[model samples]
Target: MSQFTTPPPLIEDDIVQLSYPAEHILQIKMNRPKAFNAMNNALNAALEDVLNWFESEPTLWVAVLGSTNAKAWCAGMDLKQVNLGAKTMWTRNGFGGMTQRFTRKPLIGAIRGYVLGGGSEMVMNLDISVAGEGATFGFPEVKRGVVILAGGLERLVKLVGHQRACELALTGRNISPQEAKSLGMINYVVPDDQVDAKALEIAKTIASNSPDSVMATLYGIRITDEAGSARSAHRLFVDSAPIKQVHSGENTIIGVRAFAEKKQPKWVASKL
Candidate 1:
């Protein structure tokens, strides 16, 4: 059987915490219930560290990101911390300071309460999202005389549609978890008590798969999303040496055979 290992710690204090089990799943908890886990410099830096750890750790295959309390996932950027004059395009950390970090591994968001402004963008970056029944989501930057410069508007448009996204961005409205699910913003909406459990369950399920295939699948999906032309997308994947190696490796062979035989694929985890 393939054994699992834990990733390096990413927390600096009560602001952030990271814990990993022997199932290739990294769980990152935001610890700032006092402020509704507001997005500030300290929290941003902590998130960046966690993302960096995920990118560098080869053993990990999946991540679950959530908040410490059930009242708020994140209340968005701290207005006190926002300096309008310091605006820059696609800053080092795209949205919350962890935006620039890249990883082939997937990020799953477990949202319980309000995921607003900056918080909304953070959740949108994840490949999958699971929210609690009372979860609330919004991008009220427009109400503050500021705009959604963190890629929230654009991403929201892609997530739903231009019309629906425009309504929220223009009106600065908050949508309930059920509405978010209907708009395709979340995958599952469970009871508040089941949020973390469901998120971990999904993460472990993904981690149990062949890591090589998982990475390739993620790469393909992201590349396809960015590709403007079909030819370009095809060339990008075809020229990827890592993808080629994994496709021809024993893991793929076993994964394929397992599927055909209706059995679990016996595989080993390899370093990136």
Candidate 2:
């Protein structure tokens, strides 16, 4: 691995970076260190483009979210840009386009330093997250005269409950990685040096699983949440069976094997 500032193979400029391989794991990186990698229009557009590709492209099983600069994963939308009258409907697109409903593939957020406002919201949408030990998380939108319309408040509420969400959103305060983990927001808190490695480890784990089954499991979880009526449940049920078969029974077997082996599981998946 290169320095955090070094561009990845697929990166062209300062906006974003991408790389994909046979493992079916795509890494999407925000590359604007100057503005704390703020959510600018160009970054949003690039993210949207990559997200669309990730969803439509075949054999893609998982995505890992990251930032180039170690100092800040993202400081949220460029408040200066917003203050300067820049157009910003893309904020609705979510951090690096994770909020796009059509792009329902699983994502793992690999966070390092500061993750605030839109950055915070972006992680909220990911299926799992790994934050660096020095990473800090917050909504902080209130301090900037913006509403948490990009799903930060909603997701924060879901993760930590209403009162805690209000406390963070209302104060725009920062929370350490340990606190975030305690609140159940991040899956793991690794050292700064290990952030990307841990994230890729998880992403590889996800990619190793049967792609069809992983997609279905993700779909099933989403459908369960959206199942507001019997009709919706029925539809989900109808759509879910094919997916279950694609899910490798190896996932279960690995769990049992790990327990018996008295060691951490090294999970693997193959194409269905």
Alpha-carbon TM-score of each model against the true structure:
0.88, 0.80
TM-score of 1: 0.88
Whole-model lDDT, candidate 1?
0.79
Worst 10 residues of 1 by lDDT: 1-10
Q: Candidate 2, residues 1-272: lDDT per residue as tens digits?
A: 21222222343474887776336678888889878788878788788777766766655668888988999998888888878998776744665576535346777888999998888888877788999999988887777777888765666787899898878788888999999999998899989999889988888777765556566667767676557876786687565654555544565667678889997765544233
Off by over 4 Å in 1: 1-10, 83-91, 97-102, 256-263
**Full-model lDDT for every candidate:** 0.79, 0.75
Model 2 poorest ten-residue lDDT run: 1-10
Best by lDDT: 1
In candidate 2, which residue ranges exceed 4 Å CA deviation?
Answer: 1-14, 100-103, 229-235, 238-272
Please, what's the RMSD in Å of model 1? 3.1
